[model samples]
Target: MSIVSLSSGEPTCTTEDVKAIAGANGFTITPGSVDETAFLLFANAFDATCEAIENLPEYEDPRLKPVIVDGERQCHRPDAVENPLNAWAHKTTLTIPSAKGPLAGRTIAVKDNVSVAGLPLGLGCSPGLLKDGKHPISPIDAIVVQRILAAGGTIKGTATCENLSMFAVSYTSHSGVVHNAWQPGYATGGSSSGCAALVSIGDVEEARQSGKDTRDYPLGEGVDLAVGGDQGGSIRLPAAYSGIYGLKPTHGLIPYTGIAALNPLIDHTGPMTRTVEDAALMLGVMAGYDGIDPRMTPESPMPDKVPDYARDLQAWIAGKEKAGEWTADGAAKGLRIGILKEAFDVIGLDPAVADVVKAAAERFRSLGADVNEISIPLHKHGAAIWTIAARPMMPHFVAGNPPDLLSHTMPHLQPNKIGQDYFDTLAHRNPAAVNILMNAAHLQLKYGPALARKAHMHVWELRDAYDKALEECDVLLTPCNNTVAPKHPASTAKTEDNPDGCSERIMDLFEPAIGNTLNTCSFNVTGHPAMSMPVGWGKVKEGDGRLPIGMQVVAKRWDEASILKVAKSWEVGGRWTDSR
Candidate 1:
């Protein structure tokens, strides 16, 4: 099967264009080719994308290719638009007031789960027929979104969020999967998938040949910034899979004012970008207090007008350069990084991914900060507390009484069509599905103090253990997934039987007891800032090409600045420079 060329902006790619770009970029996108080496090299050169194809190499192996439809030599490709709305509207801008003078040139993508008045707040679900004729309006902007706009950052549009922001992959109850722009064939890791996708895809090419504004840069300006919410691994997963920098900041570090709630104790809104410094500038703008969010911590609001985090980041880079820790060109000389050996191995990850992550760890060690192998025992129970606390609330939010769903209506009421349809299918399969779901709702009625007690105990233990581990290191590193981007399933639609399977796989990868909660959930639960940065490319079975690998860096709570400093150091080290 051949790919359609996207170089012409005829709304989709054409076979001939795909072939031409593939050849020029040193790879092939044909089905059944298993072109791993070519794919990795191609992915490495994505930033310099051909007249129209930057980053296509990120997922360029044979495994990355989708199975050919009908096994025929087709000349034309599908012209379907993945998330066509009533109208695309003009891609506009929203300015955020910032203490850093002004974020004049920066651009950002806000997750639909984070409310910005007027735009549909579909958290990817259908609200059903509304009794009230009035549409939902966000009384105020979600603190994070407001902060970004205030900083002079221009808003593109709301990026799609997963079903009620429940799942890890980004498809919502409204939009289906947001394909990874880095590697067209793999999953973009959800809930925050759209933000990562738009940022990675950057802007449309002027024409295919000039190659001046390669597909990698967003609108040909400053770094692309993305703001998203994570109750589980939403932000981290997509950022990692997309080979970008994504941070799940300490819980409550930023106000959640208009954002939807998943697990209040764990829910957090954060930033994603191609670089850590960009992430920092976003955080600096968005972090602070607003009385509207009862969850906001009283930390003096960190100054309503904070200086440009970019300047601080630049200074840090300069210091590293002067100290010979890193070259001015972005290669680190010496840095200390620790591998969560136990955490990385528990997921039954692909050997190639494991190898690449290990190689990255070794590279940091060679550059000279202390390197250590360590384990966080409490990580074992992470998934349990997560499910016990999170699952019971599913029915309530997914299909409970009207108010419960409406409470989080703005920005993310129902984000994905697949997710909503999935729920509808479950309801149709067994008329009792709705009743069963309602019974499982997260109301304290059933979960009360008894369940809360159990959850609290486990959480306390885990938090205590996490704090101890952080005391021993500046940051902890681990793989984003057990394998590279999992093959994008033939479709995101889920039958009742398959509903929990995908979510389960993600949970288990991050934590067994809690299942699929490995690398990300722990951070969300612990309320610490964790950043997922793409490091290298690797192969996976069924992934004909190389998939990007993400290194998860976790820091102590509210110490986002430190995490950014370290991540910037890594970024300047040339790890992602070649990630293209």
Candidate 2:
């Protein structure tokens, strides 16, 4: 259709244009404007690859049109073989065979926590702390990583993760804070921050605006891409905040062998990308039986194996697909939706956000989904799920049997490897010292789960309510976060920014933070599949301040087929573009 030509000859907005807009608006664009410019160009390139520009007519402004047009521009040859991030900044690169058949021309950025042979899988931790300073790179690849490679998807590079992929914010020993593509002053959200960063910045839309070379982008737009892992919303959070589609499949549906693990209770390896179709394709590549992970269920099977995710995408896009073709429309369409009153009332949501949630529920009703406000009494105690899961598991992370107590107490658990002399001091400490230490560990192990179980039950009650609601309707819809993205840590100006700043305190301060796990963790804990699809941006004044927001959809366990179907339906209806 020569869509680019059809657009009133208006130049798509690029990073430069955004800068102008920000400057004109009196918003002081952050100091790293150069990197910001480069990132916008990269984001555009990837947007062009997937025909995402065709969807941007709504962006309207002529100058902005050039951003998408320019973002899609490609390099004559691939830059897959070398480290792309090795240039002026701490960029990275990797190589894998291209995606097979329909995805043959596509490229991917793998999560560093997932092993790729001949490359170090540091999981963003220092090399010295690792088992031999190397991931047990399987003689056979991590099932999903190998699958993508087999599908002919090229590996761009390993994305960054929090140490052991524990935290969501992506600060690795190897890579410092990865800047957000939309606004440098903001965060891109992590442990999968690298995937989002590279994908967002790698596109031509972002690159051209920044005036960087097109071929050198980090986040590629067009190709069938995949992301790895989800535990306490690692993949989904980045996907939602960055504006992309992320699927955390039913646990054990996709094999987890060859990937690094923090705690098995919630760890899930999956794909994150720009479209549902690409997510499907990546899922196809990654799914299958691998003897390495006992978690792989022999009974579980990939949903209708296909050679390419693109084949099914056509029917979906045309609206020719049947109503029951996937999960019934997750929107209000005859769906039974539960408004977890506990989830709504308890979480410390931003004031602007509460209004958004209230409004979204109304919108679902407008769409035809049956809405019910239900109360899950346990929702108030939901934060405990993390403690219950991490306490027992944290000890395994200690280097040896008689572990170092200091390691556990560090802010954010950033590992500080101690020599024997330092180790002995703690080991041989007096009874009072030992008593205090033992008491503390006992609290974490004992109290953590109590808190987690309380939270789990509350979430479980919500799930039960959702199931009942689903029995009456189809899907549950909820606001993705309580507040819009918080101010960047750098802006906070704390060199030793307390992880707790973002973790426990602020999370409780906002409604969405605590309740997000309410809707999200149920899917994880129950082994059901769930996805968060972008509906639109929240209110401009305080709700994300123009940042995008998503609506969450959850389906019965192992019913990702339905979740994707309905989620995509809502997406097309809304013209949701996977921005990162």
Clash numbers, per candidate: 70, 71
lDDT of each: 0.58, 0.51
lDDT, candidate 1, 420-477, per-residue tens: 5445543322222233345454445565547856776787788888788777777788
Off by over 4 Å in 2: 1-99, 131-140, 172-174, 202-224, 302-337, 357-361, 397-440, 444-469, 491-519, 538-545, 577-580
Cα miss at 224, model 1 (Å)?
A: 1.6
State candidate 1's TM-score.
Answer: 0.70
lDDT of 2 by residue, 1-580 (tens): 5434333433355766657756875775564678676545544554464465545432221211111111222222124333232111112233333334444657777777765544455565445554454343222245565566555566555666654554444332233444444444445555576666555553335446666423333433332365757776777766665666777877777877556555455668887877777777777767665544655565666435422335555555444445532222443364456665665664555566656556655555555566777664544544454445444544444333322221111111223343453233222111121233354468665675465456556555645654664564455555555544444443222236543222222322222223444445545554656676555554433234355565666666655666665565555335543322
TM-scores of the models, in the given order?
Answer: 0.70, 0.64
Top-lDDT structure, candidate number: 1
**In model 2, what lDDT does residue 63 have?**
16
